[model samples]
Target: MEVYSKKQQIISAINALRHKNQTLGLVPTMGALHRGHLQLVKKALENNNMVVVSIFVNPTQFDNKEDLEKYPRTLEKDVALLKTVNKTNILVYAPTVDDMYDGLTVSQKFDFDGLEFEMEGKFRNGHFDGVGTIVKRFFEIIKPNNAYFGEKDFQQLAIIKKLVEKHNIPVNIVGCKIHREVNGLAMSSRNTRLKPEHKAEAPFIYKTLKTAKQHFGIKSANKVTEWVEKRFAKNDLLQLEYFIIADAKTLKPIKRKSNKKTYRAFIAVYADDIRLIDNIALN
Candidate 1:
């Protein structure tokens, strides 16, 4: 378990392995290192000869300045947690913001077809652009044969797949199953910021989504949307920001899901000021 911060350092290490014909995998993260993140690393290690887990809290991705400031930066704790995975081939890339951005922290706009205008894109302005820029940078720097992400951000996963196709990047983008708490809350770095009571109530987000999945075929998409909206509205602890049943590929909200098209339920919730997003396949 070695650590490198600069892009050149990791690139140098990866290049050495490339000469030996070793396959490489990457798990890019903002580094509050939870079990969810480790799952990505484990999957990467199983498939590739080497793995790089990046720990930069990218500034370009946050539309709200304070959310960026308040975002967790537990580098020491993060490294310690990564060590618990107990793999020698694993390496950590904990770059400084300056190291990653070279001083300027701006996101390049990307066209994710119409996929960018729904859910997360609709709410967090310039968010996916930041995601695209950093992800593309990592793919360029490490040049991994495979990259792993969790499906918790279902829409973001779709955008990244589109990104690879749009750019002709060679790396395979792998979406892992969502890791969750025993209580059913989708694991997120932001979960660390939840208030005590709110933390207890957070599992309801997944619970509600599960119920909504149960209702999809019986109810129309609009009615299911209504059901989810009402479920959250009745909850006193958490606020529903948006919930949509959309075609999985294009991400357009659907009136009625066709057997021909795969669909999923996407939700965003606000517990006081902290925000969380989750999705589940409805078919």
Candidate 2:
């Protein structure tokens, strides 16, 4: 796979493809590639003539400096993985922080129609602004016909849809299914940092979600949430942060169910020092 770290070179290359009427796809990611990331690549390759996977750990998105500092960066291994997926027609854009924001700053406001102030937005201050900044930059730089993302970051996927519409960006935003481990943990780069024992226990996150789903129609929202809390309380290593059932579209908390609308249960937990998030559909 060809790699470009500069914006102009990549843009020039992509424009050459555009001249040929070649359809381009983009899979934007932070380094530390895994099965989850490759799944995105696989989907992109199936649909587009050319795919560009951009791997740069965006610093501005982190609410905590320490979290950003500890975030994984394994570029060599990441590239190797991408090559294994497809060495032809795939361009890896591994750019420097300066490559994206050389002299200008990117901190802008977005209106998600009240979608921004939901679970993730409420917890991580200024986090989505950073997400918006980097994603907008990549959208402008790559100018792909389609951009793919995993629904593992469900709220982020929702926010990105808003970002595209609010700007009238001429690209289709595609949300692929959440990739998971055999034991059911939603695959994440942070999963690599889990303590060995914590890794063994990490699948419990998905297990709890499944349990929550099973209890959905059988129990009230408050009772189902309390059940999730009690279930996690049984595990000393798993610390529950917050659990709520919210409208799938608006992401606003739903106190009760409606036959006309869909709801989902979103949860955040800490396995020792590592934080993980997951959500499940609830009828």
Candidate 3:
């Protein structure tokens, strides 16, 4: 239930835990805690002797300044949610941007082996660079035995796995499941920004994704893409930005069947100004 804002304090705390022979787990988040994020914390608690949840809205990761500014920051509520965990070993490392970047806010370019060139990377230029930079910094600072991330950011998850592999970072990267609302809308901090009507319509995104998953094997990849596109085109509130069926690993768009072990339906939609993303495994 403890919180540390400064780098030295968190470092010292982790050192004390290490001396106690405690294994550390980390959940990196950009505040605005929702049930989805708490699910990640729950997984971390189950595995590690001590868990450090780092909540920092990293500026280097946002390609759009407006998007960065509009991103939610509910630190007080976030801490309250964490406090309800009933676990004393869980602590929050809510550092300031200055503490993270030391006043030099810039993203380092990374070679994600072409994994960064598709979907989110193509749309949000340098987005992966920002993600890589902040994630790498956290790994260096916390030096935890394990780190957890949700599969909602499937592409980001893939790139991070590559990041660890290429850099040989000595930590296990665990990808947790995507949590959703009752109507099937993927839980997100951005969901708070949705207008009432848009909130009602948002569940359709997941509905279509589920229906698309059903069509996946029967229809061709390209045909399934078209079906999902048409479904969104009829909606007035939600706009489909990009929908692609791809090899889950490389993220290369799949126009036809391949020998790859996995394929996934990746999507991004614009619910007016708020952009939401979700993915489903298509086997």
Worst 10 residues of 3 by lDDT: 253-262
Q: What TM-score would every model get versus the actual structure?
A: 0.98, 0.97, 0.98
lDDT of 3: 0.92
lDDT of 2 by residue, 13-62 (tens): 89889989999999999989999999999999999999999999888788
From the highest TM-score down, the ranking of the candidates is 3, 1, 2
Q: Across residues 42-71, which tens digit of lDDT does each residue of candidate 3 receive?
A: 899999999999999988878889999999
Ten residues in a row with the worst lDDT in model 2? 103-112
Poorly placed runs, candidate 1 (over 4 Å): none
Top candidate by lDDT:
3
- In order, candidate lDDTs are 0.90, 0.90, 0.92
Q: After superposition, how far is residue 254 of candidate 2 from its true place, in Å?
A: 0.7
Between 1 and 3, whose lDDT is larger?
3
